[model samples]
Target: MAQLLAEKRDFDFVMWEQFNNEKFLENEKYEAFNKKTCDMILTEARKIAIKEMLPTMAEGDKVGLKFEDGVVTTPECFKPVFDLLKEGEWGNLGVPEVMGGQGAPSFVASAVSEYFMAGRSALSSYVSMGSGAAAMIQLYGTEEQKKKYVKRMVSAEWGGTMLLTEPNAGSDVGALETSAVKNPDGTYSITGNKIFITCGEHDLCSNIIHPVLARIEGAPAGTKGISIFIVPKYFVNDDGSLGDRNDIWCTGIEHKHGIVASATCSMAMGAKGTCIGYLLGNENEGMKIMFNMMNGARMHTGLQGLAYASGAYQLALNYARERVQMRELGQPHDAPPVTIIKHPDVRRNLLWMKSYVNGMRSFYQYMDYQEELSKIADTEEERALADGIFELLTPIIKSYLANRGYEVCVQAVQVFGGAGYTKDYLAEQYMRDCKIASIYEGTCGIQAMDLLGRKMGMQGGKVFMTFLAAIQNTIDEAKGLTELADLGERTQKMLNKLGEVAAHLGKNAMSPQYKTAFAHSLPYLDVMGDTIMAWMNLWRAVTATQKLAAKPKGKDLPFYEGQIKTAEFFIRTVVPTSMGRMDTILDMCSAAIDISDEAFGGL
Candidate 1:
């Protein structure tokens, strides 16, 4: 089971060496965390994850969730683990101390999260969704609202979720029909039904607070009139004690293909005309507030990709090392069959998995570092740079990592062959659970549109240009090193071509042929994702080259060398395909849009 989680040495390399954890500790915002303390935190989290949580992963998936009337019963094994997480306060690791959380740095919290999430994503969502809600309340809630909800939410005493999707408004929030009417007091009465609400009605917490999106009576139409309200499962009194039950009820839970332990609910609010809710930010600003939380929520969604993919790759690697079935290509026919790891094809697959897993981990940590910098930077300029880059990378990290991460999981299944498809192994589960990452938190299509439509045009393209420039810096530094010169040159060429592609896409998106540009937006995002992966691999190579100069001995030698080799494998093996993909994009073929629907034979 331990072998199924992230490689600790690689995790340390990204945290301590690649991104430099020490620099984050220099900021007073993170003064409470030193390397030792962070290590202890990670160690404790790993223990809880491996020993207490990992055992429940398959058990939870098999047992799934139970719905009796309006109540949801999670997997029997999840209760103890959930209790342990809440008791240890692991859920609030990244929240600030002032806000009743442990105040760990973003990087450390992310490492801790990788362990827990890899152990069991469904169980972790309970806390994560609540923390997300608490963060919103902390940022936008009135003092009374914060006083009523934040601390309890931080402790997971009460659960939290965002209720936006209705039967009519899956992706389009403006079309939602949930309504709110002003009450005698400042509170409003909420009436609506919501679908796909995660952790919406679980038995884990005493109460569930919902940040529901509803338009007030007499408000204007469309999203401009939408307002957000804090509606709890059970009302809270003036003293913060649980009060009468609210009008919200869980109608049903979805039987999903994966993450079965999580209760994706059909929630009906104000059936009795008594659902009392307090306004969150202000009237007619719900979408704006929700968009603010979307980045974090989307990043959280992105983590699912890394979690499932890492665990799947680890499982595949372990299986290869143990499963003996193949002989080397040149070995005698009568010779002993070696472990699958000795097979060249299997080795290539493992390296393919290794390279992506390694790159994804580094890229995730890099994004976390940007978040830390944005918060801790002294100068406004530094903060802006961090903010700009973080925003620009958001869609890429969310969409690319998710889509690639799913592919990695699929590849892991392929590596395991027939055994992978059975319930006996967790590879299939990883693939199943990971499929949702690309579909949820807005689909990959939505992410592609956001990247091309909004993010590309941010600050008149300065943010996008800055991101490319940052990647170029790594390429330039790697070019100076003899060991990495060729790898860096190839990556630099890809980066240059990517810039041109971006320019072409940007122009087409604004031109009369916008439909053609939108048709290929997803492919454009794919190449961008590939380019970012290459950049991450090159960065790892530079770090490994610098470390090799120190003459590390024993296991460290292979580990450092592996980083360079992984970079070479990706740049040499995979990036040429990305270059070809870029060519197809430049061709700007309109077959997708030009084809008439009636011309298809399927009908």
Candidate 2:
């Protein structure tokens, strides 16, 4: 198989043709960047990803991390690439120039990130967390706080992490028991044990800055009284130099199934009564401050899914084209064996992988564009619309892509046959690595609850209505095109049914059967995801159809034709199943919740 991370042609088509990202150049914030500059940036990023970072992916997974005493050592291959990321300032591309970053547009940064993630998500995690931490500090920290931490974290000179989960608290973050006591020096003495802290303790950087969530001595209980503090592994002096070691220590690291290079450390703080921390934002606002990092982490988790699926698909495609199998279905018995791509079932699996990958890439790029739009919109209403839609779709993007991206990886494995299951092939590793996306940074079930519980009703349901309306507008556009008119009508039916299903779920959620409604929230999210995928595929078909009408030649012809066919495959095949799910959801069955605890059988 080729060492391809993702298809460049598809990337170009999504950004320039589908999104028309050139329009962003007209905005003053993006005026310094033009099409050529953005393309060159992607080119350089791709080079770094493919040549410098890709080699570490397999080594990291195989060799994994080594934890000894109080230190965690990452794979040796990661250090050189980590250095490249810092020296090249690659981690700060999305940060604004005013905040001491490259000031690239969000979509451009997203595209750049996709490449690096495809190369090695474990290594990329180190960069992304540092950037995310710096972003939070830049947003909510005091000027002095920013001065001490932001620049170093942004440049990847120091590492960063968010320590939230304890042995008692995972999804129920409000139930955390970490405590903080105010001290005479205007700092807080913190004590806590945090688990699953990514990049919590790594040798890639000299220092690790932790934004820990803990409750003050006299604060109220639960999430409301929580506070965020800047707890570093080594203290920073006023002169921007290193001070004595802080009390935070990594006692051990988890031996995980995948992404093994990342140090998921079990951290202990104030073991010797010397964990000093400066409060971030204000007391009792930790949830609010920590969410700034959490939300970004969710988005990053979604991208991890997309990257794994993309890399797997590319490998499967290459394998299918080269791996010869049995004779073609309709060929003579004496005929020579054909490549696996010639087989019908293999074709179906490839198409399934293709359509989802295409849809996912487009969906992520759409969100990336919306992030930029929210920032640069001319009016408050415009900004709110962009931001609101992005907000409403966050869980969908995070959960749906995660669940489906894993499915796509499964299909890739199927395409590779027996070889896919072995360590010799990356497909197996991709499967293992992508599984965590659905489980961590908010499980898929938690994301579904967030969607049904809070996001759908935002601003009196206006935001969700707006989201559906945007899909309708695409359906309407597709209806205008002769080639896509049939798919358009079919997709429109799904959209209408989704609205009805939403209403039914909403009614059930508020009434006596609210538990039943919550029981089916995952299914509701699935249907929503399917409908959205159909919408993305249909939109891509419409664009490709229009481009084909212009009579393009060479490779463009097959690519455009493939787009239309992929849409047909999903709409004709997948949407009907989603419709069935919607029907099931409408019934609001209470069986799952009504079952008696004693009736269940266990070992």
Candidate 3:
């Protein structure tokens, strides 16, 4: 119940010290917000998150969602909390002011997201869907569409969603059965059944705007033929008032594991033969338009992962500090019992969780800063470089944080022992909620394939090499410290060896042995993720080392000292196992690919 969603001290450390976020304000776009303004915003956000949203997490889970009479009803507790978020305009914090947002930098927005998401991840879907859908319209819609939708959506007066997933075509989106036909009017008649649509039928807003994907009749097959359409629950008139209800129907909602308060609906369009929709962009450019939302959602999903992990870790750490257990090792049995935090293995687990939570948090901040930099870069080359790094790290952030987040949940539960497994605690719920992060957007395996199959070869691998060089630069800077020099040298060696493995796998992906290359892609992705984690840890250490050298007084001393210890722990303890795993990947084993279907068993 005591959820300190995110650590404020560390947040400011990374924002001000590691990232130097004030530099972002030089661009007039963000000049309205200085350090004091950003810090105040963060403070206000924390207050709202704890005061309004934190209480809704359990209520939503207990009451859950209802889909009786073909109408999805959310928890009673959610309405007021959602109203607060809407009133505060937190739904679209990072967008430019012209688009009716606070115009906060992506890095600052990430901090707010961490706070809000940690309270109740299920409800955060409403905010994500609203922003994602509105962004699509703002970027690709006509002036009329923008005027009608963007402000309302950003203000949370209207709810929105991405309607891509279907029953027959889950990840293979090209195989969708939805069809679109041009009508006599400018709008088109959309006929499709979309499943797993989040925020598809929420009652928090007056109208739910759905960005649906369907194929135009007689268009090309596969993703190319797909087109995006604006299928609203109720039509909007030219004057911006709500029109007659469209043919959109929420036939049912899924009874899922976690985030039970959020509706995952089976949406029926044109079931009554009256679903009217307007084309978002040019025909057959649906994938192109949708990628913007997809990529952004992937990054948001990474934030959710970190939120879950951070909350769980905090809970575990608190429990460990309070729970009395056996005496310290090497002490007599008659000695006073020590807290579980003093237990060696428990300490190991807490440190492991801490290292990842800190690394992932810093990585999120860094990734967001890069995104903001890309938007405001002075030089074409700098923008392009940031763009490439963003692309390369997007999948990593989503999959790596998700997988690691879930692991952190498991450890948290272990720290709490039996209570963590019971309903009395929060660890189980965090694990259940975190599972969707990796599975959604794309599964871990899919992300792994995307990394090796697409991003590695993109722009002749220049983008990925740029990413490598960024890591190398961090290593180069950290290599100067007498204490951390050894870590720097070892990390460089591991990364250089990783490049070797990447080259070997890259060649194999093009060669006749491609199946084997793809088979080991997951392991290769793990290697890359850990290497980046090492980079983030080392990056933190470099700043911490400089601060400690200054002999900071009071709380600043411990904060800086802890950053160095976290970096040291992750680099020396966690990364060695990761490096050893990469050595195995370098060997290019074919056992997974060579084994026949019968050998896999239970076919």
Candidate 4:
């Protein structure tokens, strides 16, 4: 409601300074895009979001989807918003030009995603899911498959969905019971029910293409037998025109906690014995192909977390500045009532919210730049390093941002006081919408296990060592500034402790003692994420310090001062809190695994 997109400074800073768009513009593929063009795209996207999407967001939440007679119907207000997005071609921003797309760089697209996501989380889900599905098709589809689907999908003429989750298989995708039988004509017949499928069924587009994972008859068990397929709601003809409706229908929709505008449908495939699907890649290699999309989706989900946090903060900030309340200490009782923003505690919460959102934006953008580089790096070794770093940071970006972003949203509600708890305000909705981010895209616990168990040990630990070296470089650079120098000392000590933890986990991973060490894995992830963020923010402050020293005194001065102050606040407040968390982790005092299931049966 407070227009979070207009107040976004962190994204601009990352794009212009940290990510360095000039480097991308020089590429032959991105030669048409410059600063002016990027600005125009962002401006247009914001206009569409405010005019078309934001207005429907509240209405969608108020009048959620209704299920009747085996069909799911969305809020009536969602139609116009979906139409505007389709007309604007915003869904095709990063798609290749050969497929009738704008072919923008990933960094630019990431920025656009943040703006849209901040405006309305539910509407953005439709676009992101479609784009993610299109990316998968573009990457692995055969030439004929690409010609049949890519153009329409890129233009948003066709919507897309990923059908991986089932009632029995959520995070353990390998446990899926969906079956695919090869027909004589080469197309496979798919049969299964998929639950919690977002954008699975909607009248917003002419067709819906689903990337489904199923197992072939008599195939090897577990993940080894899994295969990816493209199943459309309607079969496409050789001439690329719609042909016949396939045997896929929405059986019902979930009564979700939030994101009510996007339909989370329960789908039945091959109930009538005619669901046709085409394999995307080689048999038994489906998991490998799907990871391409899952990894991207995980990152985009992190962006959604940041978006909700920023939106909540923006609303709270506006309320704080406008709503009058009781007087602070040292003020005259007769003095006019002042806004809550005048109070130090409220200001502290708002600053914490701001710093966390800003740090996440910068960190996420850096990861996007790494992904783009992985695609275009000239040398194999450089590409390999980029790939490894991207892999290592993905779990952190997803787990840390989702966990902290939700906390920041809670703080934002606190800033709003009583009004925040009521449905009359949007803060409560933001909290509900953001809560799922941690549970989906693999839970925070799963991400921690991935980080500690696999990523840190990949390629004989070279990637972890590289990341440590980067953190060390930040420390070395910060040594010249006294305030940051002290902060760097503490961060380095935490980094040392993390290294020790990694070593201990590596040595005893096979024994039953590993479970004891595993209990602290999540805390290790939190400490690692905070350490990385502090390192990045300090680097930014160092840059701001240099710029401030050379600038003329004016309005520009406050911007630099804000940057410096935020860095100091984060180091003093946040870093020390992370130290305490690390101590608890080292203490290994939690009873999480030791307790019996019956102890919690009261629920």
Candidate 5:
């Protein structure tokens, strides 16, 4: 409960020294927010998280949402926390100012959200959904639509949910069975059932605005026919007053593995032939419009992973420092029992978790900075390149961090031994909460396919090479530090291997042997993720080294020294493991394809 989201020095290093976020103040859009203002906002958000949200986290999980008589009810403890979030106006930090939003930079918004998420992931669901919905309207909504919904959503007077997944269309969204029929008055009647709708049916807010994907009558089949509609739980009168309830009902609720406090409902729309819906944009462009929300949700999912990992790491570290165990060699029988932190293996695991968690936070923050730059870049070419890099890194950010972050959570539990598996401790819940990050948004396999199959070839490989070049820049900068010289060298080697794999896949994409290349793409993604993370850590180490050298005996000396040690741990221990994956890629293993349907019949 002691707000262990991110260290102050680490956050400052990332914000001022690493990304130089102060430069954004020169732009008119960010001129209203100076470094002091942003820091103040972050501090306030952190306090709200630690005080209001963290206290109810365990209670919310224990007394999760309940569904009966077509209504979903969250735990009693959630109301005050939700009220605190709305009253603080933390929900509207990233929306445009005209719509009652503060228009904060993505970097600051992401950092605040990361802290809250670290405190209570389930409670953070409503805020995340609201922000995603507001972003959709900002990107593609008409002026009237923005005026109608965006303000309410941003202010948290109303909530939002993305209704895309159906019972049969989990991953293959193209196969969605939802349908819509247009009426003479310009409104449409939507009919469908959506499953696993997070924040789908909750009483935390007065209204819930759902962005549903459905196929209009007479439209083409498959993904091209899908359209997005704005369907609210309660209808809004022309005079801007709340009207009668719409016909969207929660038919059931999912008994999920984690985030139990957030209602995951199975909703039936137009079952009573009265679900009125408004089209968001042009017809047959629903997928394109939904991408805006999807991208935001994907980034948030990565942060969710970060949050759980950070929480688990902090808890495990605390436990290791306090829990006593038998002494190792060179200790007398009379010697007092030592804390587990004194063990070499325990230290290794703890350091590994710390290194990866810190590196992931920096990686995610850098992505947020890139997102801000994509919108505020001075030149068209810079904007275009930024957009390209965002596209290429989206899948990596989603898949790599989620997958590896879960690994860290598991390691955190491992550090606790048998005690970690008990419900009496929070580590079990942390592991459960982290599992959903990789599955939702998009599965790791889907992300790997997107990264290797599509993103690698986007814009004729310009984007991919731009990404490689960025990492190369970090490597070049790190070369001057003798401590990181070998890390820089190994990073270059991994990048070269990545390029070779990319070239092989590119050349064989159209050939009969393409399947062989595709078989090992996931491994390639792992290698790529490890390489990029190492590059980020080395860059951090180089900066920390300079700071440590400047003040030989200051209070910050240990902090800087820890940064260097974490970087060395990651580069030396983790990067070497990727060599096996690189070899696996070159071999073009087709074992997955070789397995037949009968082979899995045992399930």
Candidate 6:
């Protein structure tokens, strides 16, 4: 099997052709970068992924993590890979140079992360949490906080974790019981037990910084009263050196189904009443401050979905091309057995994986571009639109991409038959690892609610309408192209149905029949995801059509035409079924709401 993380040609096409990443060069923020420089950086990232990081995948999975006496140790083989990520500065790809980073654009950083994550998501978790912690400090922490933590986290001299989920508080963060008491020195003495803390306690770094969510004494009872605190494993001196250990300990690590090398810990703070935690933001503003990090984490989780799916698809593709099983459906019984790639059903599954993988890539890149636009838009209106659309799509991008990415992983396993189910192959591991992406961060159901309940009505629905109009515009563009006209019509019809369903559900959600409407939220989200994918594929096809029309002399004819074909397959084969789901949502049947508790009988 070819060691694949991502297809470079596809990456180039998306960056140079579809997205025009060159546009960033026009902005002063990116004045130091150009096409060659960006490409070279990506090339180096790829080398690091394939050569250095890839070797740790199986070792980490097989050896997993060891928890003993409150310390978590990852696979011995991973120690070198962890160091490589820090020394090569892969963890600081998007941070500003002033903060000791490479200052890459979001899209470029996303691309690099896809490769690194595809290499070893478990190890990548340590880097991700550290970088996320640094970003939060950079955005909201006081100057002293930034000076103390940001550079160290970005430099990977220390790692970090977001300690929000407690034993009693997972999805309902408002129900947390952790308490923070103010001490004489103006710092808080944090006391709490947080569960599901990824990289909570690891030997890879000398120190770990925790952004803990706890209720300050006399604060309100719910999420409104929560505050964020930065509690480091080792206290820092006034002159920037390590001091005595803080009152935090890792009780134990979970033996997870996969990504086992990443320590998922149960952490206890202030066990000895000495956990010195400095306030991250103002009291009672923790959720607001945490959003700055949660939003980014959601996006990165979406990328994990894409990365794992890509990993499975890559391995499956290689296996299919080499593993012969039976003759083609139409071939003679006496004929030689062909590779599974020649089988019709195998081909169908491959195309399914390819289409969704392609859509996910485009979706993530577009989201990253929007994030950049929110920062660098030429006008206030442009910035507002970028921010609104980004807010609207974050849930869908996170949940929808994860759902489909996992589906792709399942299909990859199917492509490999028995081998895919066995430990000899990585497909099962991919499935196991990707499963958490949908569950944590926010479950698909939670995301669906966010999409329908909040995003749909955002800014009196201007964002929703604007997004729909853009899809319509693309549909109109593709409708004029002779070869793509049919797929364009299919996509347009899905858009109209989706628009209607969104209005129906959004309106009903406010009425007395909210449960009935909410019951269908996940289904509605699926329909929206399908429509968005149709939009992405159709847009890609339109780009390919126009490019082929202008540059007919290119040797890359097949690749361009494949784009059109992929769009065609998705429109004809995928979008139609999603439209049926739209019909189901429009029906608004009350069976789920009306059914008695006993109907969901004994397990």
- Model 4: number of backbone collisions: 0
Model 2 CA lDDT for position 553 = 100
Q: Which segments of model 6 are wrong by more than 4 Å?
A: 1-3, 551-555
With a 3 Å backbone cut-off (N, CA, C), the pairs that clash in candidate 6 are none
Residue 93 in model 1: lDDT: 90
Model 1, span 86-186: residue lDDT tens: 99899999988867998998888888888888899889999788888898899999998999999999889899999999999987889999999998888
Question: Candidate 5 lDDT, tens digit per residue, 358-377?
Answer: 88888898887788778989
**Each prediction's whole-model lDDT (CA):** 0.90, 0.90, 0.88, 0.82, 0.85, 0.88
- At residue 162, what lDDT does model 4 achieve? 85
lDDT of 6 by residue, 47-155 (tens): 8888888777877899988888988888998888889888888899898887778788998899999999888888898887888888888888899999988888998
Lowest-scoring 10 consecutive residues by lDDT in candidate 5?
A: 1-10
Candidate 3 residue spans exceeding 4 A from truth: 1-3
Cα shift from native, residue 186, model 3 (Å): 2.0
- Two-way TM-score contest, 2 vs 4, winner: 2
Residue range 1-603, candidate 4, lDDT tens digits: 455443545556678765576787888888789888987887787777667776777888998877786666767887777777778888888777887888898888887887787777887776667667877888889999888888888788888888889999998999999999999999999999999888898767788999999999988988899999999998999988899989988998878888777788999999977899999988888899998888988898788788888778888888899899988758999888889999999989988987887788778887877877887888988788889999998899998999888998899889888898888778788888888889887889999988888888889999888888877887787777765677667667767876776676666554576786678878888888898778777767776776677883875578667767877788788888887887777666648767788987796
Query: Tens digit of lDDT per residue, candidate 3, span 1-603?
Result: 343667688889999999898888888887788899889989898888778888778778889988887788889999888888887788888876877887888888889989998888888888768777889999999998899888888888889999999989888999998999999878899888999988889788899999999999998999999999998888898899999999999989999988888899999999986898899989999999999999999998888889999989998998998999889999997999999999989989998999999999989988988898798899998998888888988888989999999899889999999999997887788888888888888788998999999888877889888888888998998888897898899889878988998999999999999999999898888888898889889999899998888889998998888888888899889888987888788788899888989999997
Task: Specify the poorest-scoring 10-residue window by lDDT in model 2.
Answer: 1-10
lDDT of 6 at 471: 91
Better of 3 and 5 by TM-score: 3
Error of 5 at 406 (Å): 1.0
Candidate 4, clashing residue pairs?
Answer: none
Q: On a 0 to 100 scale, what is the lDDT of residue 582 in model 6?
A: 88
Candidate 2 lDDT over residue span 292-391, tens digit each? 8888888888898899999899899999999998999988999999999999999899998998999999999989888878988889998898998898
